[model samples]
Target: MTNVASPVAVVTTMDGRRPYGTTVSAFASLSLAPPMVLVSLDDRSQQLAIIRRTGRFGLNILSTRQAALAAAFARSGPDKFEGVAWSPSEGLPRLPDSAAWIAAEVDDYISAGDHTILLAQAVTAESAEGSPGPLTYHQRSFGTHTPLAP
Candidate 1:
């Protein structure tokens, strides 16, 4: 999937009083009527394990200026949010100034190869009015999308 451009997002949830998150590019809208989305996580991801226990999560769609944040969350560590700026929304970590945000509850889990796909129903969704274009990943690099002239 390296050739395919995918939006970068951080999946967040609370493990007790602490916040857990992971950067992911395997996220996509699933339905409009019910406002659902799909996020694929490694079977062994600790974030996934937390979501299983809490059944709730938040999706922070990173803006172009937030590529560093994405890289930080992608690492395996307890201090990913050590100096990060965020707040709690719907009891999940909310990153400020993101391109978009979605609070969701996991509706189902599907095992696929080495990853488990979380089919979630969006409980709330919002977009920043003047946020920068979404951060994207392609060819193993981080970038942003540009619209083509009509």
Candidate 2:
């Protein structure tokens, strides 16, 4: 799917008193009537295990300037948030300066191939004012979206 361009995001959850997260590109709006989202995670992802245990998570849609942050969380480790600035929102870790944020409760988990698809209901949603364009991944490189002339 390297040819497919996708928005970058970080899926965060609290593991006891510690915060954990992973970078993902497979997130999408699943529904509107009931405010829902779908996030796909590798079956072996530690973050997925946390979400299963807690039944909740926060999605931080990264901004154009957050490519480094995305790379940081994408690494396999527990220190992804070591120096990252964030706060608790609805009891979940919320990254600062993201393009958008969504806190959701897991409604179901669907197993597909090597990944688990989380069907979640959004409990809280927010968009930053004048945030930079969304961060994107395409062809194994980080980038951002640009509007075409009308």
Candidate 3:
């Protein structure tokens, strides 16, 4: 398995009422046969704990302009969503600037060394008016998406 995402993924879940840690990393689909996607979160992360207990999560594809959001979520974190602008639907926290957002139900969890693999079924989705591409994590820093020439 390769350790890279099509673009960095931002995972969010509610903490009682407030949104906590927006996790960003190289995440991708684990199985199309079963409609499954996986995200790797550190074992000690609050996001992992919330996902396990609530059994639901949202995957938000960040647009290139959302580099700050990506960095706020990706770097060594603590209350990552502190000042981020977002709203909630069915209790799922949504970042409005995301290129696309998908809501999912936890199907299973896999233990992979330092991280827990969250395998979930994408149940609902919304497409935002994106500026262009997505936020990419590469070379130990964050990168923005670029539009290719026709």
Residue pairs whose backbone atoms clash in candidate 2: none
TM-scores, all candidates, are 0.98, 0.98, 0.84
Winning candidate number (lDDT):
2
* Window of ten residues with lowest summed lDDT in model 1: 76-85
Off by over 4 Å in 1: none
lDDT measured at residue 29 in model 1 versus the true structure, 0 to 100: 99
**What clash count goes with each model?**
0, 0, 0
Clashing pairs in 3: none
| Model 3 worst lDDT window (10 residues) | 1-10
The sequence of per-residue lDDT tens digits that candidate 1 reaches over residues 3-106 is: 99999999999999999899999999999999999999999988999999999999999999999999999999888889999999999999998999999999
Flag regions of model 2 displaced more than 4 Å: none
**Which residue runs of candidate 3 sit more than 4 Å off their true CA positions?**
1-6, 32-34, 145-150
Which model, 2 or 3, shows the larger lDDT?
2
lDDT of 3 at 115: 89
Better of 1 and 2 by lDDT: 2
